[model samples]
Target: MTTSLVDAESVLAIEIGSIHTRALLFDVVDGQYRFIGAGRAPTTIHAPFFDISEGIHLAISHLQEITSRILLEESRLILPGKADGSGVDQVVLTYTAGQPLRVVVMGLLEDVSVESARRLAASAHTIITEAIGLNDRRPPEAQIDALLRARPDLIILSGGTDQGASRSIAKNVDLLTFALQIIPREKRPEVIYAGNHALVTPVKDVLSTYTQVHVAPNLRPEIDVENLSPAQDILADAEFHIRSRQIGGLQSYRSILAVEPLSAPFAFARMIRFLSRINNPGKGVIGVDLGAGNLIIASAFQGNSAVSVLPMGTGPGMAQALRTIPISEISRWLPIHIPESVVEDYLWHKTLHPTLLPVTTETAAVEQAAIRQVLWNGLNQHRTRYPNTPLLAEPILAAGMPLTQWSPQTSLMLLVDGLQPFGITTFVQDAHGLTAALGIISTNNAILPVQVIESNAFVNLGTVIVPLSNARYGTSILKVKVEYEAGNQISLEVRQGSVTALPIQTGQTARVHLQPLRPITIDPIGKDTTRSFKVIGGVCGVIVDARGRPLSLPTDAARRRDMLKKWAAGFGA
Candidate 1:
């Protein structure tokens, strides 16, 4: 078994989305890991071919042609390579195409355990069909009726402190058992007991007799403290178990997978946690995976982490986003003055032709405009659900179809104008979907993730500096100075409500200094009146977003359009 980064000479990572399945290849060059090539094919989990392995094989076929490497042996993969050179040493997989998991949460109290269960559901793309608790006004029989009506795929039973309750939990469990008996034996939802530790065996014994039972650590160890990571792990496992069977296609490739297949959103969230642990501990790390149908916002701060999976994205899977983000809101991000009706028509047309690439600049701009709105909507969802999780983070990472489909500068500006994050941070793009792959690979080979991440496996969008102040619009806000490694130096000033970029190419390094003109804070900590740091070059150099904290666009349509254009020009998009 490969236990370290150096042991693997070739790696193949696959991410299967609803619309597309992408195969990315990474290999060692001069004793260091590098992204070699990638291939894409339409996902075949639906319609005429219900097997996803067909899509996976086709993608790898393209990868073979691209690199002139033999990766397949007829119908099966050529694993562990051959002495004559044809195949990979390891293969990893992630997917985001399964049906959303439906859940029924039952707790002792409404605000304590029940709320925590809801948060757990929010961590993944799950629907809470019913929330039952001791505080529930309905009678026990009515609660049972509700649970059976919901027909949840999984039931989360959480309540009481570590050793607080026995009788109350038993009462709920007895009621749950009766409800399970009511449903057909094959239709019973799997149970997850995350309540008092003392009842673990009893809960499992009774529930396992009816259906599968998963035990997780107490979600609420104490009244004031909430522990969720372990429960989240169980949730992800249960989701994988439930969806793997639902898809049917995964069964064919399940035996050959290097590790257990992981849901793309859950894998992406785990990746964010790993990245956050290694990143700035005080600020936090936020990563977004905007897939074809769903978008996930994963944030980790200090020791706490939050994940929100929303039904929002670029093309075909935008029904939920449209309900919230109006045509005018999308138009606000467009540089051209297209009418709201026209913009809506374009989006509807794109939704129908989800795979069609934009041929005209107008259509592309409209698509990007909609993308900004989706990003904005996702950010708002994160803030609303997990307010305690800080948005001030370093290296805001973006992934999924939108990032890969658009230019780097376009992705950067959409993130800036949509997320509107404050303080100084770096912007990174996961165009290859390596973040999830690395996270999954780290489960077995811990060193591979660190080495590959430090290598050129991801794109560097550059450092983003946002100044916060109470200065009037158009007033000078911050002064920047850059001292290049070769001894060249320059300084500039930026006014409030505007954006600008510094000339720092990729693979270059410089020492940067900043001073707020009107006593603004550039870093997460408010005390830094002056700041200096060594920075690296990226696709877009140092960005000074003097656009202030709560980026507000002009009320007039034309004015907002021009302002959006100015920001795009600033990034040279």
Candidate 2:
């Protein structure tokens, strides 16, 4: 009998990213899965070494040296661990190195089918260059010209309910067929028919001659319910196949893996879904990864998740981010006065050399300021997708430079300043960059994720209590009394527009009694009601942010710098 994936003792996980290639070793020690060692090397997808496997090998070699184990046999990863525990039992791969999928969505309705297609595209890290709707005013020739100009890698055709209209659907299909004919056969984009099942055969018959056509279950089968998983799965598989061919030697990389590789953003969405399902019920989970090349925001609520990948990040995306946020907005987060021109220059330099670390306080401040805006932009985009979902009360997990490279206090402050959570919320950081890898691992064995999370794979940044109110800056916001360990009591006062941190060490839990003054409300459970709850502490302990809703900074440059300095001091950043 084959051993179950959960019973497999050792696993080797690799992540190939735009900037770095990381390898991690996980083994079942003392009958539980735990992370053993890790290694990272600069990605070799560019110039001299175009093959991604070169960096993978180097990273694995570093891991072998650290763990004193042989991972590669004849330049290929060893599988099914030897009797002496010399090799791993499984290998999992994930990557974020190639260009995002360029997708064109064609639908009849903007709200129903088009919206569904857009959500699927976002989850797959696709850049939607063109969306053709029935109500579009563009002429047929204009639409076809635009589609050809866009040069999409894939086209998603979704419209019409189960037994809905057929004339409009046929017209759109005819338009697509004509467009596909004009493009060269070798360069024609693949087609995914996710419209009415009744039209699948005719749709396939029309497009199969010029391009490969895939039939997915209708996205809006009945108009009231949406079954998007089938279409999303197809899109993910198509994306993986297309990307594997684009990235040299990635097909060989896939052949050596235990299972098919997953896109980093898709894997992240899976991880957040798992975390949200098992860890917190009723409340949602939010995850943000602000990398040098891309910014990814994923959220999970009630077992469903959505992901948004913005190409605006710390490196190449910095230029795009600068266009979105003004220089003065970024300057307000800096503690010291720096000229806007100098700040702009530094950002451009970073775009040229993304891997360089900030050695000076000024540079670090600039990077943090940019990070704040990146998070702000990402959050706004997320809210646009999930308008009614409340992200402020969800548990947040953040990764990348701003959180991993800074002090715990500084990282926490950046998150607080950027996210501005309301009510009671938990914050954690992916210090080791293992969330995506673990997400892929979880797909093979459900039990492994629980084991790894329980083993402290993430750094807990502690819980924050944010009261929703608008009051005078100097007035009292709330009074908190903590009772812990043999009835010891500590009383603390939080004033409006101020942040207070209480040191409560890891592995300790405290019972907190919160009394909000008049006009102030603790929105976690109820409004303007005194509440008593238990909270856990982590590296930075519990933080009480009495900052008002829609946090504002001073308009004056001098005062803003001074206020930012005070805020940084308050958090011990």
lDDT scores in order: 0.82, 0.83
**lDDT tens digits by residue: candidate 1, 431-538:** 777887777777777666777789777888888888787899889887888899989999998888878888788878999888768878776555555488888988
On TM-score, the leading prediction is 2
Candidate 1: misplaced stretches above 4 Å? 1-5, 302-304, 524-526
Q: What is the lDDT of residue 248 in candidate 2?
A: 75
lDDT of 2 by residue, 418-457 (tens): 8777778888898888888888988777777788878888
Candidate 1: TM-score?
0.94
Q: How far is candidate 1 from the true structure (C-alpha RMSD, Å)?
A: 2.4
